[model samples]
Target: MPAAATVNSPRHAMSDTLNQPTSFSAIDFLRTKSLANVVQAEIERMIIDGEFQPNERVNENALSQRLGVSRGPIREACSALAAMGLIEIIPNRGFFIRALSSDESQDLSEARAGIFGCMAMMLAERVTVAQIAILRALLARMDEIVALGEVHTYYPVNLEFHKQIASMAGNNRLGSIYQSFVRELHIQRYRALSSPDVLHISNAEHREIVDAVEARDPVRALIAGRAHILNGIVRAKKAQQAGEATAQAKAAPRRTRRTAAAMEETAAGTPADAATKPRARRGGLSKTD
Candidate 1:
């Protein structure tokens, strides 16, 4: 029988607060853990689902109040997110959610291409029969999701599929680092090029990658993966440019809207004399009776 697969366990850090044997210390530790979990889950969900919005400032005070946690925990959570590249920290200016940019997206895509290429090559060299079967099953499921048009369900599964393969490549450090960058990269790409059709295309490209890997062709898999990432980068860049153009185009209309609103308010606030012209009646201007 095949041996059970081993998974890495989460590492726990020693706490300085552990020295305090009082109930208050215990409660504080639990509270800190809860706060960190809540804040991390909320922020991650917002970023992945595009609810937080790009280039928006994260209001730490409001977030702390909403989460029912103190500002300290909120600050700690924001620091963690910033470390994960999910947010941009401007010194003395506070944390802002990172925006999708063409250049940045392209750079990430190129890096992903190189990393994923190396991973795929490694997997091709060392993947076991069981691993191959697992990959095939995942690819089948992915195809099923595509057939059913379940885009949302497919997205996370697809991410996990790639991440799992990267993990199986026998280098713990490489897999860990690759996994760390994957989610943020996906979120950025999706922000720039969010469309059902494009997602379907991506799935098809993934199919090609799986086929190459299953064939145990290292060069083929590497090339396919690199090409897929390169194409995605191109598409993301175009989408980012398009987004910027659309925003620029709307600027004029936005200004016009603001001007019209101001004029309406001014008209509403004006005295009657400013709004109505004085008229002469019977060759004389009328005055107070």
Candidate 2:
């Protein structure tokens, strides 16, 4: 065949290869990411809200049904969460909710403190009067909750107050990072704020942040924001210690009871084997008379 004829051939080998459809493309990748993002958000909410407890296996089938999506999206979501330290994937056993270690929790808290401080600083410079009013209203509502000693009720509202701060800060990247930390610290945050005193203290810190922001004092606001979370670390530690003491106290009684039972057994002076064996007569024989 002439060179011109070969160049224009319809059945060219290169053309056939080029025309073959790819198994996956950019469109497919984007669609998968979109679906997985939805799944990831829902499952993240479940874990952070304690709907799915720590160390519990993630039920992909249940999630797929609930979200009305396939297991592929659910698995993809779980893998993403695992990367965020919200879940763990083990070979053969599947994904489970991750429980942060003490050090891990502290590291997350400190990083969150930094993010929150930055948000407060940014808000102080650019915050509107309406935002201040919103925060003040949240604080007022929190005061009522504190007075009523409603830890459970106060916790969600506290979350909202901080969320509003993040949103108002107007930095999407910072807000996203702050929210991730919040999710990771949910368990510890709840435990810390479970106390009435802690609730009062937390609300007071909220006031400090609002006060500084209202006055347009970024330094004060930064300090207040960092202090709020760092103080929470203190409260969290105390709460954990107190909980441990209570557990030890409760376990102490059981341990004492076990000890007493063991002592009583020893006092009875009857061995199980001794009961089964024949008693020797005259110190030497069975004495079959």
Candidate 3:
């Protein structure tokens, strides 16, 4: 018989993808949970905060010693993060955080506009009074955080606002996908909105989006979300440029140390594959470049 016809349905495709197993088992899922998860979470936080600059080696030995764990779990956690696309793996080298690019940022904003707009439209049709009340309370908290200028905590609160809106949109899949981008996207937004003049404008747009959602006006909500995302893209590019400039200045001294390490390693004539390898991504978040 000819090869069986593939199920082309969206539901079937999503089910197949989500059901795929990771490299580890549940009981042993977190062998030495405290150390591995702690290291993973801390590294993730650094990526979100832009501390461990993108596209740079994540030293397994260094992190292993720092977190007081064997290289095995550290390697496992790095593998998990690579699976999440928060980091990238290069042949003959270790993992590095994914970098930002102008085109990629534009594409992401467009994707957010499309997905979030669909969500808002669905939510408007099904939203209850109680849901609106809950959202209003959350927005109030965001406003308070913004007013206090507690920059760090503002991101989590901001993510909560988006998550609530996504949940209200009545699509679990959309919400799950949106949640994945929470770390990177929020960091981008925070960087862009750091300026005093731009900060209030972003807050105003957020309020507008909430108002639209409350009014059950999908079109307005869609427009508001799109405008917000595009503005964020512009601001992020500016911020990333400034940040990269600062980082380059700091990299001058570190460059010499890195060069020496690379030369020493080369002189040893060790095979590159001895290092941790990055898993090949079949496809999902289309690899751009």
Candidate 4:
């Protein structure tokens, strides 16, 4: 039988390939990032874009279908997001977008202020002329945006300005932590800086910070950075209060109308005009008397 036709045929050349060393490529590195990371990033974008409102439930099935992925990856992604403080998971209710309470938001702002202050101080000590030039260029761009009254476009440039400062600080860990804080405060910061006046004020603060850094005055840089973030917190609070007040003003008339309707229902069988008129006293003297 031709020696039973040796099993190691030319077509079955697995031994040679198996013995060879494996090599990695860009694709392998990309694959190492995991599907969950990709899903997490996309979900983060959705939250940042306000597609998912605070406290809104995350529909795993819907996201799975939308992203063309399996439910396992969606769950994994949600778990990662939860770890990042961007989502909350309930035992039986599933995951909901995390909403920071006012106190919590304030606390985060304070913490970020400290971190940013330190970053600014470090950058002031270590920043080079090239870095300062880059920052000035960004400021120029911001100035142009402000001149055009395009407040919306200023937000991204504002973020880039701060990020460049953090980068120039030469501390990767600090940059990573600062980035997390920025992500957490993304929506709130946008709301805070939405006003053109607030944007101008913030840009002025940025200029002060840049000036301090350029002068290599770490103490001044620290104070400027801290003040800028603290001012942002105040501005955000004021904006929130103003929004609430406006909403209440808009709703007051509707609520009053509702109450009036309920009163009318209670006084059924009375004339419509009588609802607004005070009832006459019983057994009182007539006007003729």
Candidate 5:
């Protein structure tokens, strides 16, 4: 019976072996050729995944140990990320994940709106039936995702939908510039979508953009696409203001208590109160005498 069991175990092991890849491909070797780029991509993924919060310091030593690489490649990766605007270097301190200020976020949104609006206009003039079909399919998928209240799941799809529009425009230089803008906008959009209400409003704007595109009206498409992105700016600003208001509300009571305690101390230590009490002069005589 034991021999039969061993024979069955060997058969199971063989079946598992058959399911596994026998060897790595050429692409695998190409990925390892640039250690800094590989490390940069991993760190960028961590930032996008919210593993590292905005302005949080990245621990070089800890990352090196975890990634099984030395500090040199890690430092190089940090510099690369900084160049890409994903992280910032603090001179003597270290690298920290970048967070855009409200004003900066607004500026980025406006810039993106102009570029994307142009792309939409261009696509409207030149888009084929197949391209329109692709955009419609993505819109349908986004609508389904939003209906199910899966806002988080819709972010990547939203990016891909815009990217497809940029690609369909068929301007390589414009596409390159648009890609950079989109990369920086990712974090800002994520913050805006923190409120579920924004999801419905945003997708509604997306539908308008698609309608304008399908109608082959360049001016209307430009307006729709640009308005959608500008509205994103407004939503991002509102979210920022809401966060600030909440933080201030939480700190208000603490500030009030501290102010009250300070006032009490000041009253107790007043010169008028001290003057009411008797005091010996320095020469062992009262001032009245």
Candidate 6:
């Protein structure tokens, strides 16, 4: 098997967290090997599945009850998650799912692009025939999914395809970083690939990556890999803008029936004694009122 971090293995993720200083103590490290690790994985799964949405506070008491554990384990697991860039720990507050701003998301995508590009170059020069076959199979699977235009199904396969390449690159360090970035990008990636067209376009780039690797063209492989992620950043930005526009439209309330009628009355010139007319009682105005 490749030296990649398995789909949800905590060992590799813990190792990365242990190396980083997020106030994750030695005691917490040992806890991860024990009960806390299970809790961590469950919470990670929740985030991945969008059960626990971004910026939503994790109710520790609720988790403790749900997992049949005390708050201690829940807290420890959340601390570990914070280290993994999946949660944010606010002083005096609590843990929340990490929500990346557009700028921060762009920074992370650029970073991943650099590392993924480098790994693609490595794969081009040394990938074995078996690895190539695995990639081809994933590509075929993705093509099938795209034909049906099922992005929800295609997204995970797309992730697996890139992860397979990261593992086949033969560098554990790069693979670990790539995995962490992948974890961080999960929420935004769904937005970046909001439609079947995006999924189809993304896989086309994957074809370039595979072809370059097969031809042992390191330069072409690197370009293809970097371009894939950089283009994804553009998609992410577009997604962000679209979301913002939607939010703005929501925030600017629609003109109520009463307001519209008042505007019309003013436009047509109100009667001279309109002020003397008994004003209607103040009440909430419905859209159709």
TM-score of each: 0.70, 0.73, 0.67, 0.76, 0.77, 0.73
Better of 1 and 3 by lDDT: 1
Question: In terms of TM-score, how similar is model 1 to the real structure?
Answer: 0.70
**Model 3 root-mean-square deviation:** 20.7
* Model 2 quality (TM-score): 0.73
Which window of ten consecutive residues has the lowest lDDT sum in model 5?
278-287
Query: Model 1 misses residue 271 by how many Å?
Result: 13
C-alpha lDDT (0 to 100) for residue 41 of candidate 6: 85
Judging by lDDT against the true structure, name the best candidate.
2
Q: Indicate the worst ten consecutive residues by lDDT in candidate 4.
A: 276-285
Candidate 3 contains a number of clashing pairs equal to 0
Q: Specify the poorest-scoring 10-residue window by lDDT in model 1.
A: 4-13
Residue pairs clashing in model 6 are none
Better of 1 and 2 by TM-score: 2
Which residue pairs in candidate 2 have backbone atoms (N, alpha carbon, C) closer than 3 angstroms, thus clashing?
none
List, residue by residue over 1-289, the lDDT tens digit for candidate 2: 6987887787686786665666346556666768789789889777756588778998888888888999998999899988888888989999999888999999999999999999999999999999999999999999999999988799889999999999999999999999889878887888898688778889989999999999999999999999999999989889989988999999999999999987887787547536645544334463543
RMSD of each: 10.5, 12.2, 20.7, 9.8, 5.5, 12.6
Expressed as tens digits, the lDDT of each residue in 1-289 for candidate 4 is: 5544555665446665555555345466567879888888889878876688788999988999999999998999899888888899999999999889998899899999999999999999988999999999999899888877676688889989989988999999999999999888877887787677777788899999999999999999999999999999989889888888999999999999999988887687456456445435322436436
Better model by TM-score: candidate 2 vs candidate 5: 5
Question: In candidate 2, which residue ranges exceed 4 Å CA deviation?
Answer: 1-46, 49-53, 56-80, 269-289
- Error of model 5, residue 9, in angstroms: 17
Per residue, candidate 1 scores C-alpha lDDT tens digits across 108-213 of: 7788888888888788787788988887788788778777776567777777777777887788887777767675686765643365566668777877887788
Q: What's the lDDT for candidate 6?
A: 0.87
